[model samples]
Target chain A: MTALIDIKDVSHTFATDGGPLHVLDHLNISIEEGGFTAVVGPSGCGKSTLTRLVSGLMKPDEGEVWLHGERVKGPRSTVGMAFQNPVLLEWRTILDNVILPLEIVPNKLSRAERVDRAEFLLGLVGLTGFEDKKPSELSGGMRQRASLCRALVHKPEVLILDEPFGALDAFTREDLWQTMHKVKSEEPFTGLLITHDLRESIFLADQVVVMSGRPAHAQYIMDVPSTGERVIDDLYTPDSAERLNILRHQIQIAQGREPADVEAAQ
Target chain B: MSLKKIAIPTIAVIIFLLLWELLVWANGWPNFVMASPSDLGPAYVRYWDLFLINGWQTLWRTVAGLALAIVFGTALGMIMGFSKVMRDALYPLLVGFNAIPKATVVPIIALMFVGAHDFNTVLIAFMISFFPIAVSVSIGLSTLEPEYRDILRSLGASKMTIFWKIALPKTLPEFFGALKVAVTLAFIGTNLMEIVSPHGRGLGALFDSGRTNSDYPLMFAVLIALAFLGIVLYYVVVVLEKIFAGWAERQET
Candidate 1:
């Protein structure tokens, strides 16, 4: 499969009061077309920074990032992004928020087309009747769902999720993971997820990349078994627990912690 | 709950007006010195036609000035909001200009636009009203949520697209708020110009003439008429805000 994204020996640093701080060091990775990949690490491990680099929000200090064979210079419409916070526009209704991306795209669709697209996406997210509600009127999970619909409305090639579900409660996070899985099953696209949830990474990702603590570097890359028939119930199985355990151990090593302690905590 | 809210304010206004009327009656002041509410009422009825004409002229001048201020102020504000270079270069100058007492410049304004009384009144009104709009709009545009801008940028939205879709809409609530104040200021500015210049038929001209000749009843009538006009114009802007910013206001509450 062709690589849709290529990060070639990239490094990034920031000038701080203490001194020059290295965030990512000589990172090299490539995401294949239509693959669902997750980057996991400890807090401050620059996982989110990597997502910013790939999405062209920030530039690397060294090397290059190529998207669809072009150098990643600045933000591009071909990528959709969602942050940990839902960040829905408070002044807009749920439907209007979903239609925001369409407003920004060049030669935007007509009002009728835009409304049709918004309604379809809102329905897809189970918010069909709540279209007129404002962001403040919705619960946290519903707000996040609306945000997800907004991100996908423009149909970008790559979806960059920087802990999009991190702020949700456990149940909501799990529910959204399933919702995401179902969405991907129907309309698959390349995704880059930066998350700290070990089980979440193992559950949804086709491959999981572990990173070392800040001055982050890729420490391990493990392929997840693609159980095409696996459903949400499979997450509670012993086999799934074992895979999660192994991934947790890899993360512990990356963070310079004892793997045994991490296993015990789990 | 709604009844109590309305009842309280209505009762307060009635009591206040009654006290004023009683004070004038008890003092037995001459109508020339202080016209009671009864005297003012009859005077208003007698001069209603003339008041309406002058009132309409003042209202038109206020609206024209306010509309021009909105157009120019919104454009300048958007430019200042998005461009750091423009902000740095122009913001201090804007602040300085805003600080000068607009009333003090009435003579200069009249002199500059000699032979055009209505135009001078409009010029003064525009000067008074434009500053708040520019300041409020710039602040609103500058304070957009970072995530919203990020969403637009990630979508490869062009500068114009982002300005119209994100920046402009974000400033509507603030613009309307500033507009409310701007309309009131425009009314005051027009009245002040008429007071100083005293050329055409206007509430201010009527006021100047009444005060000069000790036509206390006419002056009192015009004052009431001006107050009514101000209240009506203010509520008009409020109604517009309720219509355009309905979604945003709901979010706040």
Candidate 2:
């Protein structure tokens, strides 16, 4: 079967006041249906830009993005997005905010059905009773949970998480990582996560793609050895440490702190 | 609002009136030159009928002009917000027009549509007031967080959908803030036309008549009436803002 998302040698350049700034250079990545992939790179390696490309929010200057073997010319309702800031509308109750995507996307579901859908997701995220509360009433973690439900409420084909848990504290972040696993098992969707935390990548994703510095491409791709269901304690295993070390070394090479030969010698 | 909030301003106004009465008494200024707060009381009772008729005229004209400003300003603002080309084209012209003293244009408007006093008064109010609303609304639209927009766009939302679902609500706080200011400007605009193009209507015309007869107490009474109307209108906006955009306000709880 064709990959659910196929980015074909995408290249992009942004015009700045100083002149043209190259961001992505001949980058290629693909995610199979129901697969989760995490992208980790330097601060400005155009990882966020990659999410925009897959979602079709913006077109790559050179390459074509294909979804289910079709070129993405513009944004698709099949794609759902979540960011670090949940950005729930203050005017809306948590339930209403979660239902926002359903309102925007074309749907046959009645209002009652829509509420049922959002309520289910919110329950999965442990936000059961806070549906009537405003966004400000919830803690940061709770708000992000509502944001995740909003993304999934429409049962999107692809869910783009642009550092969705980046702003949370360590404990909350880990809790969310497990919640992510639970959410995916309940609502299967192709997931593309853009993150900076290395531990987060191995914990949540079956595959991690390390990207090089600016004008980045996928420098190294690692298949996380599946050990059935994942838990936070699983990250402490000796096997998981070795994998983390390898990925860390690769990132050093990508960052130009260590020569590529240093890894080859080891 | 708390009772303390209302009581504080009320007490301050009473103190202010007492000081004014004391000043008039000490100075022993002629009644024709300066009227004390006590003098204003009798003047109000004497001209109570005239105040009702003229005050109603000014009140309606101000409300009508502000209503027009809100409609026209919101449309213009949405256009400027959505299109960069239109914003660039219209902004400079709007700024220039707004800069022209509205008082100077009152007579020109009066001359252009001779005897259309009500229209001229309403137009001046709209002209003076709409700029802030348009400018505030455009600012609100332009500064929208890109992440919120991207969330919608990825869902294949149209521009209109994004505007209604996201942009319009986000712009409410700014819109209401601009409305508060524009209401005051609308009052000033109506009064300007009434005073300059006096056509036997509004408190402004009454004030002018008091000046002609050298009835200082009557002039002060009219001034007090204008201030009262402005306050009532301003509080109406504040109450409406509380009802509509209450979420924008920071809650103590």
Candidate 3:
């Protein structure tokens, strides 16, 4: 079966004041339709750059990015994005903020239909009564939830989450992990998450890809063993611990603290 | 609005007026040398007609000039905000023009317009006021968060879409702030033109008339009227700011 998203030998560089800064080096990734992939690595590993390329915000210098078998030349309307800052419009209420994308992307939905759609997602995220509240009125975690609804409101073919929950507290982050599962089970859009948390990657994603430090490429790919339904307790199980251990050791190799051949020798 | 908000400023003004009256009484200054707050009441009643006519003229001139400034400043600001090349080219010229003393420019404008009294007043007001609006708007737009634009761009939003949805709304608080400052500058501009070219119109011309006749009470009354006008216009902007960009004032709980 063909993949819904494909990145082929992609390489990119930035022209900085100090000559060129190479960011991505011959990176390759592919996600099947409805797949959830989490990318984790050392800080500044070009993970965010990868999201930009996949979402068609920027073009790859050396290779092609294919979405649903179509070459992405510019920004695509079928990709949704969320960031660490949430970035909700201060002038708009929660409902209106979620309805923003519909106003931009061409659609046959009526105004009433758009509101209904946004309202449905807001309800799913447990923000039913906050329809009229301004972004400032919501808590940080609640704002992030509203941001998630906005990304999915457009019903995009792919969702790119660039550390959407990175700013939340530990408990809030865990709660959002559950919310993610709920959102996925119902909405079923292809998701690409970039995170610094290893446990977060293993818990939420079906597949976790570890990337090398800057001038990064895909260094390790681990397929999470299928469990019926994931819960917070699943993170503490022996199976989960073993997988986390391996992933952590791979990250050490990626960060250059451990020799590359150590894992191979084992 | 709260009573405290209103009462506090009113009390301050009354105390200020009383202090001025006490100073005049203590120094035994003549009316020509200094008119006390008590003296202002008679002067106001005596030249009430002049105050009405000239004050109306100044108010309209300030408003008209400010409306024009809003139009021209927003256009110029959008250009500077959107295009880096335009910002680089036009910003220096704008700064240079704004740097010149508006008082000196008033006589030059009078010379250029020669008998076009109303137009000169309005033009001066627009010239002095437009700079703040343009500078504030450009600063607001240029400093906008990139992540906001990226959110829309990734969804295939056009430049125009991004501007209407993101740029315009985000710049409103700053725009209103500039407008508050611009309104005061506009009053100064209108008065400058009126005084420089004494065309028998506006509060500044009225003040000039009182000066020539040695009517110190009339002069002080006109100054008070001008202050009252400035205060009223400033509050009008504050109200509009509340209506439009009230979200910026939201408190974190």
Worst ten-residue run, lDDT, model 1 chain B?
B244-253
lDDT of model 2, residue A204? 89
Model 3 Cα lDDT, one tens digit per residue, B76-184: 9999998899999999999999999999998898899899999999999999999989988888889999999999998888899899899998999999999999999
* Model 1, span A118-237: residue lDDT tens: 888777777889999889899999999899888888888889999999999999898888888877776667989999898888778888888888888888888887775346788899
Q: What is the DockQ for all candidates, taken in turn?
A: 0.52, 0.81, 0.83
The C-alpha stretches of model 2 lying farther than 4 A from their native spots are A259-266, B1-6
lDDT for each residue of candidate 1 in B1-253, tens digit (9 for 90 to 100): 9999879978987797788789898998888878877778887788788898999999999899998999999988988888789989989999899889887899998788898988898888998999889988888988988777788888877777777777887789999989989988999899999888888668999899888988899998898889889988998998898887766775335
Compared with the true structure, what per-residue lDDT tens digits does model 3 show for residues A1-266? 67999999999998999999899999999998988999999998899899999988899899999999999999988999999999999989999999999988889999999999999999998999999999988899999999999999989989999999999999999999999998988888998999999999989998999999889999999998656358999999998999999898888988887655666777
Better-scoring candidate (DockQ), 2 or 3 = 3
**What are the runs in model 1 whose C-alpha is more than 4 Å off?**
A14-22, A42-45, A89-93, A102-120, A132-136, A229-266, B1-15, B26-34, B251-253
- Please report, in order, the local distance difference test score of every candidate based on alpha carbons: 0.85, 0.93, 0.93
Q: Estimate the TM-score of every prediction.
A: 0.87, 0.95, 0.96
Instruction: Show the colliding residue pairs in model 1.
Output: none
State interface RMSD in Å for all models: 1.6, 0.7, 0.7
